[model samples]
Target: MQYTGASIRKTAAHFNIPSFKAVSQWERIYYEQGKDALFKEQRGRTSKMGTKRPKKPKTNIETNEDLLAQVQRLRMENEYLKKLNALIQKRERSEKSTK
Candidate 1:
């Protein structure tokens, strides 16, 4: 493997890889171990045991109501933060004018 001193991102982009981390990992493995190391599969191949989680079923109306509630909460939070910021700026302006 001839590495021409190219940046990891550039090499990843050249190979059309979405994540540069994968390219860097491969590069590290290639440089540390040998080319043969890259040929081996990932460590967790044989066991393939994954955690299972149960899914909760929610009705469409309930889901929509939950989403709307979250949206309203976020909007109220945004408005409160805006007002707080305006008050802080006003206080700072008043302090500056007094000095």
Candidate 2:
């Protein structure tokens, strides 16, 4: 499409594509890296050096112990928060009663 000297918007409208910017991007990629670039997966953020950053694992499922430790930590946090809330409510009630 770009080789014929047509504008990005004209080409996009002719092909019924939603965005002219997307057509311009495709043209840029095609010119820089050939047709293969159009089919390649382009997920994730690129690093400062222009390479794809390594993706981190979604979950740390290396061992049962790790999962158990996370659950225990979360339980402790929940208990602490509940105790703090109870103390705040008690103080508020005492203050209201005195007033």
Return the top candidate by lDDT.
Answer: 2
Worst 10-residue lDDT window, candidate 1: 55-64
Q: Which pairs, if any, clash in model 1?
A: none
Q: Could you give candidate 2's per-residue lDDT for residues 31-96 as a string of tens digits?
A: 899999899988778755867789897784568888899899999999999999999999999999
Whole-model alpha-carbon lDDT for candidate 2: 0.90
lDDT string for model 1 (1-99, tens) is 255888889888988999999998898898899899999887644766778877767555467788999999999999999999999999999999999
When superposed on Cα atoms, how far off is each prediction in RMSD?
21.9, 15.4
What lDDT score belongs to each candidate, Candidate 1 first?
0.87, 0.90
Best by TM-score: 2
TM-scores of the candidates in the order shown: 0.40, 0.41
